[model samples]
Target chain A: MPLNDQLPALNREFIAHFGEMGSRWGINRTVGQIYALLFLSPKPLCADEIAESLEFSRSNVSMGLKELQAWRLVRLRHVPGDRREYFGAPDDVWEIFRVLAEERRRREVEPTLTMLRSALQETPATDDERHAQERMRQMHEFISRLMIWFDDVQKLAPETAVQLMSMGSMVTRVLEAKDRLTGRNTKKQSSPS
Target chain B: MPLNDQLPALNREFIAHFGEMGSRWGINRTVGQIYALLFLSPKPLCADEIAESLEFSRSNVSMGLKELQAWRLVRLRHVPGDRREYFGAPDDVWEIFRVLAEERRRREVEPTLTMLRSALQETPATDDERHAQERMRQMHEFISRLMIWFDDVQKLAPETAVQLMSMGSMVTRVLEAKDRLTGRNTKKQSSPS
Candidate 1:
């Protein structure tokens, strides 16, 4: 398929912008473009279609699809009676978000957590070392707490997560109510006194 | 100062790892190393000290510091009776997180929002274009909602945000309680019934 023939100007612009945005965020430009094309396509697209539509080499499309698959950002499906593999993004945008979050946590956050833990295990031999260890401890604790909260949030069904997010300021109000029920002051604390 | 004299072996390892991590995340390795060094330093470090400690060229150190300053991730300070400027990370890790979130929103998220908005304004000339516009609308709505929620959270005192996060599973419980109070079932909704 001719790229200009199939993809309208608006679609082409959006795909190009998406590709640029992806590269800025550490994703490969071609992979981003491929994902953008598949995301907007109403039907699953085979590798040949993606290559032809994006004007990317077959090898480039293959590599991009492989990377997307590894990130779990795209799904592979076999169209009925068709032997070639087809790729598509999840229908729900939230599902795409869930995959991105989970993958980032696994690839980046988990390793950082490990590094912090190991640093904490090393005994400090000097005042400077002691101070560094303290800093690492704080970092580790903060990350640990965040991960726990994230895991809990991830456990919620996607629809429930959407409902909870839709709550918006109501969630803050709920926290305030909890504080009131526990008899803790909601006022900002500026000092110990 | 000697390149390897003041920094302990553990510090060297940590700083090196941080540089690697930074590169993986689209940050320059030198910048990451400089930031990590400053983060663990007991006092603000001068450019010469950072260059020597990290074994980086003076020019590289200068460029890295400039980038860090732009990101608002490092502070310039002058020690008493000292002419040269020194750099340090914020004492509070949470403060660093706040700066990072703010800077990312300003640099990356806001521009993408603009692009999505512009795409949404264009009239679709075909069903395919219409579907693509619909996808863009979902993305724009999701991002807008997230930014609003983030702005609200950012307004919360750091301690309050920590408290809210520390609530962990209790947050879900609070949401369930609110739903119950409002006479809504807590069962997970797979679809609108």
Candidate 2:
């Protein structure tokens, strides 16, 4: 039974869009489609149901689920009386976001940070090396600062994080006011957009 | 002359690393190598120097520079009296981050937002459609909030932004204190991991 035959037009379109977007981001198309379908599913779906819904082969569905689990994008469950495992996306969108941000930091960012730290530790034997080392230091410092801030925000309850984002320039205003009092605004970092 | 022969060991290693990373991110290996070489040069470098240093063909270097310029990763320059064009990365790492962030948002994030908006606009004709629409609404809301925060922060002076990040959860504390005073701390968004 092809469950996709019963899918609402909107569901097909939504799943298709995510399939395209996911492929662009290095995830395979079938994996993206499976995740999108699972994401919008009103209840947990077993692998067979998943295959039928997306018209994916059983093996493909299994592999896609494995990839999604590796990305922490989906969770597994045992439906009490059923012998098959069921999979589902986290209910809260914020939770999905946290998993993605943290996972990407682990996969993509950690490698570069590791490379940078090692590069910075090497003693430069030439002027070119010295200049490159300076650039690396700046890169490492900025990324580390950004990551620390990320860790702090992720620790906050989602509501608190949302509130902070909505507060907008209120935080920057505080910095500006402190700068005014301390006369620390002399040097400006200008960037042409 | 093969300028790669003159490359400092550190510079060679740095260029090699970026080349590998770039390919993983969809940018080609040669383009990444070209950008890496230009980035480390003490002065703006012409296409010939770039080709020689990366051991890339003349056509490859030209194409890479064009791609880099499109990504806004490198700027085109004219040497004082030389007819040949030179290219260089922005001297400020912060500025490079800004360009990369903005470019990625334009290329990747905007399309998803557009799709979500369109999906939300369609009238739901089924229960499945209704559920899918609700999910799309949540996605749009969260992404819009994040983009707004990014815009607000990008408007700040680099030093101010650095100060804000280094403040390390101070902003979250303000929200926490407010929640405590308002008696609005009851509904927690629980997330696993």
Tell me the tens digit of each residue's lDDT in model 2 across A1-193.
3337778877888788888877776788899899989888888999999888888899999999999999999999999999999999987777788888888888778988998899898999888789888888877787887787678566554564455444434445444444544457523322212
- Output the worst ten-in-a-row residue range by lDDT, candidate 1 chain A: A184-193
How far residue A102's Cα lies from its native spot in candidate 1, in Å, is 0.7
Error of 1 at A137 (Å): 0.5
Q: What TM-score does prediction 2 earn? A: 0.83
* Residues B1-193, model 2: lDDT tens digits: 2337779877777788888777766687788888878777888999988877778789989888888999999988897788999899988767788888899899889998998888888999978689888988877887887788678667654654355434444445444443444456523323211
| Candidate 1 regions with alpha-carbon error over 4 angstroms | A1-5, A160-165, A183-193, B1-5, B158-170, B176-193
The global C-alpha lDDT for each of the candidates, from Candidate 1 onward, is: 0.79, 0.76
DockQ of all candidates, in order?
0.40, 0.30
Q: Which consecutive 10 residues in model 1 chain B have the weakest lDDT in total? A: B184-193
Q: CA lDDT of B81 in candidate 2?
A: 82
Interface RMSD of each: 4.9, 7.1
